[model samples]
Target chain A: MSEFLRFVSHQIEDFAMQVTFNPVEGTGTVVYNLSLVRVEDLEQTISVFRATCEAGVSPSSLIRILYAGEELDGFVIPQNFCGILTLCSTTLDGLLLQRGIPSNPIGGGVIEVAENIPKRFTHLIKYEYTTIDPLQVLVSQEITSVHQVMKHGNGSILGNIRECHMEAEDDVEEVLDELTEGYFTGILDLGLPNTPCLGVAVDPQYMGLAALGGTNWMAALREEGISVTMQAMKGLCDISTMEFVSQL
Target chain B: MSEFLRFVSHQIEDFAMQVTFNPVEGTGTVVYNLSLVRVEDLEQTISVFRATCEAGVSPSSLIRILYAGEELDGFVIPQNFCGILTLCSTTLDGLLLQRGIPSNPIGGGVIEVAENIPKRFTHLIKYEYTTIDPLQVLVSQEITSVHQVMKHGNGSILGNIRECHMEAEDDVEEVLDELTEGYFTGILDLGLPNTPCLGVAVDPQYMGLAALGGTNWMAALREEGISVTMQAMKGLCDISTMEFVSQL
Candidate 1:
């Protein structure tokens, strides 16, 4: 069981990971497969975990799933599918990477939002200097005002900054355009080459890109005094397999 | 004498620092006077150092003096004026500060120039991480292609980035406009609030400003194997007392 948990925690997207829990037998199976995830196994596991998903409850407020990515449309999954779920943030990162743009993570921070518009970052920690995910540290600190932002359209939420070389400027725009067409959200801003995006400085010859963090909705839950477990950037999965919370 | 040398090296602008070298006396006096500098003494010192001023020579290529600031109009003074010289870069910093804007030094870098136009930065060192001035380090590394830029309108030269809060954006713009009218030339770019200028990012709620370093010409000199000693941001001076290199 410990080994299975470890696999789930460290899983990456190219590989498929599946976990099944049976309270009656006090037994479970953890599969680390490189091929297509067995649909039967995933469906069965989803059913078991779905019982606790609280039909009609907001994914962020629900005790089980928080988001498949930053709270864009609030995707939720069964607890059993926790670590294998794909994140919208990483998916965007992946799409950019696939096009040969080297996206370098600059930092993560609490971005202040006014009238649902990201205004500026109130606190930041660079990814290069941290031992853990900076966003995770921030979310755990409970310093965010995501709840207020949601309720009043003014507050703070989690976000991150990344940079890509200016030479790929055209390609980046294309990717962003495609993502928008595909109904993707959470991208806060894209700066011009050699410019700070969302108030963060980027290195020379690179353009900064800021996005709302995938785990921001979880922060809202944590703010409301709910004990929730999150495995951020757990691993990659076929983005198609993930369903938007609205659809669920 | 060593003490005087140290004081010269560490001089700040608020205090009037004067040094008079007399080879005949085999000694020099370094004065750190907080009061207004006596004009008679300054004129006498200036005459003595003016011997090496090389009439009609570009201040950048002359061995005696570089600039009162960056090579904007190529201002040159005598070698005797080196340490006490004012810089266009710090002058802008001061103006911003006077307007209640805290201009935070971000980094020093080698900015690429194409067709006599500032393009992008090729290298950078954050000021926060270094004990020595980052520009001095880059200049000494002998990696700049400043000479090529000067000759062929393409190469690299030194520049720096500083940021000031967005709340004072109007004040900052006012200072910039005044400087431009006054023939100040070191400023390369000023970003909109929360944007990067000249390929460097600014902190949230702040705007990044990129300027040609006062010592950029020194980089050009260094590239040509001419040994140069630079006391960057050594001190401030009355802007009126200085003459444009072209005028000289």
Candidate 2:
């Protein structure tokens, strides 16, 4: 009774993340997707969610705090607030190191908290863990660098390229129609392989079409010509709002 | 200057593992491939590698223990020993619980050392860490239950299935050729969707072709019909000898 596998990616709407495992019930479940437009971004997302509840929460797992649906008490983290959010797992990294605040190492990977956070309260959400074993669902690319988006603009140089495998359905639809027609004619055929690529291979049982066909395949790779600006980071709230949106 | 994506699966000779990340150098580089044929399997792989160097050894990381190429000295773990084998990140886990011997939770996932080990020193080598991002490299399956392989025969019920993905590259070669042709015609058409399966996708740039294509893809999925009893648990030393080989 142990055979599980789940993989979700940047579902959007502020944030979303997922990675579940079973490996014959050895257990592994990591989820991240935090939000807080302001209010000092809820004290640095409750001091990085109480340093992931002091690094180890797994008594089958539970660490309360959910609003709208109800269930919110004390709401502690540098002395409380109760607008009450959704996910909560008893944030307690020793009450954010007694109060100096600094705790990130939820034991896996990703979860950066970008240099002690705070760029308008970093865009939280990025979980990490790696043992390996994710098979299908491929095709998600969003590159950038036409000389750093013509020197800065388009979200100032972006990057996101995903690829998965296991193999065989007409060579996986001829390698997803030859990497989506060679990254949409290699990013606007700048001679042949320009630099604004965009690939897609969604359909893991139509995973909301890999985020709605990667947003209409990056708007058809920016209406075919490819001068698109940003949109690449993917999840953990686009890598915690990429250094405060690449420093504006 | 960061952007690394590595995925290596089961490169055997006892075991081999790899996972390198650098989302921007927040860092992630788990690796394992220990050894110690006997001498009481190096005191239970140094008491399960000193309970993963006392649950957490990342003060910016560096444990030290390498062999053959050099580095060994004190040896530590359950005191010390020196015939010196290989890879030894300075074994510590609180000096094997201050010499009592009990350490498990090498962080990540799937690495349970189960009670006092030793079913022939439980096949040592199983690296656990699950956050999931391992893409591309799937195909390795070994299932059982043809009524438990004819009432307890083929090593009595087995398990193994591998897969990884993040996306991009002709949609990662068409979702690894439609999950390797729907897990090889769903394990070999017993009416067009049999059961016994096998899939393998290990190829972090030919890390010795995941132990030579996982032993010729489990002997060609047991001569094409699929009855593979077991042989699918490729890295981290077959998941730390799966509960000492599923309790024999």
lDDT of 1 by residue, A1-248 (tens): 11111121122222212322121232332111111113334443334223212221111111122322323223434333332242435445555655778667676677778887887766665554322344544555556877677667787888877788999988888776655432344678788887667667778898888877756655655665553444455443333344444355
A113: Cα error in model 1, Å:
1.1
Off by over 4 Å in 1: A1-88, B1-248
DockQ of each: 0.01, 0.02
iRMS of each prediction: 19.9, 14.4
In model 1, state the lDDT of residue B84: 26
| Consecutive 10-residue window with the lowest summed lDDT within model 2 chain B | B183-192
**Per-residue alpha-carbon lDDT of model 2 for B48-96, expressed as tens digits?**
3233222221111122232233332332323232222212111111112
Off by over 4 Å in 2: A1-4, A9-248, B1-5, B9-45, B48-248
Pairs in steric clash, model 1? A12-A236, A13-A236, A70-A214, A196-B196, A201-B201, A201-B202, A202-B201, B13-B236, B70-B214
lDDT tens digits, residue span A1-248, model 2:
01232212312211212322221232333222122123434444344333322321111112222223332232222222223121111111111222332222121111111222201100111222222211111112222112222223222111122222222223333323432321111111111021111221222321100101112222223323332221222222111111111122
Error of 1 at A199 (Å): 2.4
* lDDT value, residue A222 of candidate 1: 60
